[model samples]
Target: MANAASGMAVHDECKLKFLELKTKRTHRFIVFKIEEKQKQVIVEKVGDPTRSYEDFTASLPADECRYAVYDFDFVTEENCQKSRIFFIAWSPDTSRVRSKMIYASSKDRFKRELDGIQVDLQATDPTEMGLDVIKSRAS
Candidate 1:
């Protein structure tokens, strides 16, 4: 489906892969990129379930805008194991202004397609969405 604001269509594979991650924990994280020429969002990479959060973060480009989803597993104060799905909007400070604007405008629509996201994070730098931040939010 195409988002009205940016006229960016999401590829079918995007949702399919997300469903695998959400329901079966098939992936640790999924990175998505906007293909301006195609005017669509496409799956850039899929991290293995054994991958660390640091590996997921490393998948994002140093100076680009992208979107990602991560399945975070953590233990509660009561020692209960739980998981939270996070939708991340990544717009680095060094990215092009046009790219940032496009991502910002289309973020909500794109995120809505993923049915089970529990936490929403917007990060311009790595520090903003650090492990501590995710852990705190998951708690």
Candidate 2:
């Protein structure tokens, strides 16, 4: 589907992979990027189910804007195991203004395609979406 505001169509694989992650736990996270040439949002990477959160963070480019979804599992204060699906908007400070604008404009529509996200995070640096922040949000 395409968003009128951003004029970006989300690649079919993006939603398909997200379904596998959300329902089958086939992946720990999925990273997406906007293909300026194609005017489409495409899946850039998929973290294996056993991958750590650090691996997910590392998959992102240092000077780019991307969208990602992470399946976070944690033990709660009540001693229960829980999971939260996070929609992350990653726009590092070093990215170009045009790239940032494209991602910012397309984020909501892209997120809406992934129906099960439980948390929304906007991160400009590692500190913003660090494990500590995720842990806090999970609880």
Candidate 3:
């Protein structure tokens, strides 16, 4: 394994492609609030409080940063790739969402993989990811 500061164990060709891929694609870009002291991030819906969720960023208490945030909307399962995220709908077709996270990874395979992360959405089933549903009928 490469040292934490040195770099990633990746090839040059892949590096070039990674750059292009990331530049070409953007992530879901959901709104979020960061709690450094608590190491927590809460993902909120756009102008919709009834639909929202929160998740823990770290196991131990540590100082976190917004740079640690990520997209989670392109999920195939509950809490997609992790890092507090979301995805863009690829097409009008309901099934194949854009899944921006994949593009982010392709851009830099080992740039800074923030593993062991989670994202909370307003609904139990994130309408996009299909997690659970929250009864936010509106006040």
TM-score against truth, every candidate: 0.98, 0.98, 0.19
After superposition on all C-alphas, the RMSD of every candidate to the true structure, in Å, is: 0.6, 0.7, 16.6
The residue-by-residue lDDT of candidate 2 on 64-100, one tens digit each, is: 9999999999998899999999999999999999999
Residue 62's lDDT in candidate 2: 97
Model 1 per-residue lDDT tens digits across residues 8-41: 9999999999999999999999999999999999
Sort order, TM-score high to low: 1, 2, 3
Off by over 4 Å in 3: 1-51, 54-112, 118-128, 131-139
Clashes (N, CA, C under 3 Å) per candidate: 0, 0, 17
Displacement of residue 125 (Cα, Å) in model 1 is: 0.5
Stretches of candidate 2 exceeding 4 Å from the true structure: none
Candidate models: Cα lDDT each = 0.95, 0.94, 0.28
TM value for model 1 = 0.98
The per-residue C-alpha lDDT of model 2 at residue 104 equals 95
- Can you tell me which runs of candidate 1 are displaced by over 4 Å? none
